[model samples]
Target: MPVLSGAEPFAHDGSEDIGVLLCHGFTSTPQSMRAWGEHLAAEGCTVRCPRLPGHGTRWQDLNQTAWRDWYDTVDAEFDELRGRCRSVFVFGQSMGGTLALRLAQQHPDIAGIVLVNPSVTTLRRAARLLPVLCRVVPAASGITGDIAKPDGFELAYDRLPLRAMASLQQLWRVVRGELGQVRQPLLLFRSNTDHVVEPVNSAIVLDEVRSSDLTEVVLTDSFHVATLDHDAPTVFSGSVEFLQRIHRERAEEVV
Candidate 1:
């Protein structure tokens, strides 16, 4: 059992061949993924949710980080999982999902991907004014309006980081360009009332990916943060089933 460092803010008991590495969305902490990781761990799998750079701390801390640093954080976590598990699965929420997609493209060791309200594409209106808005906006918190936060978690800031938003736009551009290359099995969850990523992003994944096996669940009862919302149990059970099926298939292949 490899002990994860608190600097990463992850909870892992041991190394298991079947491992799941979870990434939380931008402006969020691994705490968001903690419940799902615990649920999965109870089902006899090793699970980890690592805090990305600039997360689990102050919002200004994130403003200093770039996409590469964020990606590298997840990448290191993925590498650790690869070392311990015979097969690995990756999942993420919102911006984290964007990182998962990038990882799935590059890591053949990854067996599957689960995306929860992933921000595959930037907000539509923002996409048009990305260049100017990114510069115009200042580093602050990311929460706004009546955004219902996950229980017990406070957003690092109340305003969005302009440069980080710009980086997201750029990351989406990269993911969009490489969409066809993501051939891993996929499980996509999207909220019907999501105020963030557009619905069409999930539709794009359903349409463009060449993967023969894909499943999508529409969370009718939740808002953007479905993993921690009313439909969270559904999210947990469905994801565990998906991971189990993939694990079984791999086990049979080895036999």
Candidate 2:
């Protein structure tokens, strides 16, 4: 599983004690979140965007790995950031958002969470048969590059491995059931015309999370890959504002 050129992981050491951990979606690379991480880094925030195992590589290799591998990678990164930074927040897109939510459930001490077009359920009817279907075939057509931004590629494999996708479905079920345990502040950005994930998934998350400080922003001109789409600036600037607002509130509480 040789990593691609643009799919390498990104880490930035900002001057601020605050840190941000960015997680890209399933079948996608750190390239998907590079701009957002760099934007946060420019704002003096320490940012780490790790490429998930088997990702940024080949889809066939991804079939051999499960969701636990991906979760462990991000969890280890979060633990490392927790040790170095005064306050650490997590940002995730699509399946990465599901991972972020799981991290929050395990660690309520986290500063906050930011999610974009997170996927927690299956909108595709065929996904339901994954458990049985994966045994029959190893791969399927990928659903990447669902962006309105011209020439925007996800730097992902053209094939989607059914085994890995089945594992993802299991992860979604676990995270969805534990949504109520999420107590940290939440900022979610949903794209209006997302082709990959449905809006109902976001609606379910909003209804279940117990976070008192919750905000949802709708992107009117973007698709599933909004971080690289027309409204990417919205996600970038809005996340900064979210972080600043939460930082201030925590400061006020201490005062």
Candidate 3:
């Protein structure tokens, strides 16, 4: 399948000492994360952002994919980064955050993790009907492009695929159950007024994760897609700082 014009996956080989794996949200393309990846690369960090399966092509294609497919893609990228760099970090936006957490849980060597408006659970009442709706409804209104900036946009599908979302919910359950296994340093960015994911999602992550190094920055100006919104610089800069701090700490421990 041909990727959308701006949705192709991107990579930057900046340094062998540090690598960052970026993951975009469900139904969204790598375009949403390209700028952030470039920022990390500018800071001398090797960066990679992979296009998740069933994304950046057609919404219907997502229906044929499961959450495991998305996780597998990022997992492979993480392994490749780990092989190339002395230390590796994982950054994720939305469902991508869920995958990041799962990676940390599964891989004890992840240097750290960063998240933007990650979704672990939703308060939407309609979600209760997904089990049945996915059987009858193929798609619903998309929850994309929630940027507060006037010109900011995410390359995402306009329709939400039911089966894919159902698979995502299953992934949430698995991640939440294994939160205690995620002990890596963590930084999370949450939008104060997100239209897609609620604040409770971040709260759940901070509360449940076993990471002793935890930080949260509230985004006052952005919505769900803070990585592309007015507070994008905050997300980008803060992530770089977090990576530096974690790398320093790891170096000290090694010394």
Candidate 4:
């Protein structure tokens, strides 16, 4: 299947030595993170938002892929920025947030992390039946376009591939186990009425992660896709400020 029109990956090389790796969620495309990436780029920060494997394409293709393939892609993107930049930060929404935590777990040198409604676990009872559901029915209704902004769009697969969802659960479990290892300074933006990831997801991270420098901001109006919703400016501006703080603190540490 041909990729969606506006679902391509994006990258920008800025004059600053700091780099930011942005990631979207399951069944989602780089389009979800484009605004945040562009905002960082405009502020003279190198940014990369890669199209995850099996995403931004036909839903059928997503079923053929798994978490490993997706993680490998973002991991490579991280390696690229690590080589070129003096410091690197990661930003993600939903499952992208899960992947970002995985990156921080594996690479401890990351400057920090900024997340928007990241998903680590789902308390939904229906999720428990996924293994059987995958065999009986390949997919169900997708979860996308949850932004509160009127006419807001999320470029993602319309069908929720059950197999892909199963893979995501595995990632969630694995990341949860390693949550204690993510010590980077963190900033997480959460939506009050998110239809996707819930408050428990954030609670687990806040309770488990060892990062002493952590901040959480609650969005009163935006839904899951806060990056493109009304609070986007809050997210974008907060991220720039977060990165700047990390940069200054890191430099001070060197002295």
Residue pairs with backbone overlap in model 4: none
Q: What is the TM-score of each candidate against the true structure?
A: 0.90, 0.98, 0.99, 0.98
Candidates in descending TM-score order: 3, 4, 2, 1
Candidate 1 C-alpha error for residue 24, in Å: 0.4
- Residue 200 of model 3 has an lDDT of 89
Is candidate 1 or 4 superior in lDDT?
4
Which parts of model 2 are misplaced by more than 4 Å?
none
Each model's Cα RMSD? 3.8, 0.9, 0.7, 0.9
Clashing pairs in 2: none
lDDT tens digits, residues 1-255, model 2? 568999999999985568999999999999999999999999999999999988987889999999999999999999989988877999999999999999999999899999999999977889889999999999999989999988777788788899999999999999999999999999999999988899999999999999999999999989999999999999999999998888778878889
Q: How many backbone clashes does candidate 2 have?
A: 0
Clash pairs (backbone) in predicted model 1: 141-157, 141-158, 141-159
| Cα deviation of 160, candidate 3, in Å | 0.3
Clashes of each: 3, 0, 0, 0
After superposition, candidate 4 runs with Cα above 4 Å error:
none
Per-model lDDT = 0.78, 0.93, 0.94, 0.92
True-vs-predicted CA distance for residue 170, candidate 4, Å: 0.3
lDDT, model 4: 0.92
lDDT of candidate 3 over 68-102, digit per residue (tens): 99999999999999999999999999999999999
- Candidate 1, position 181, lDDT: 85
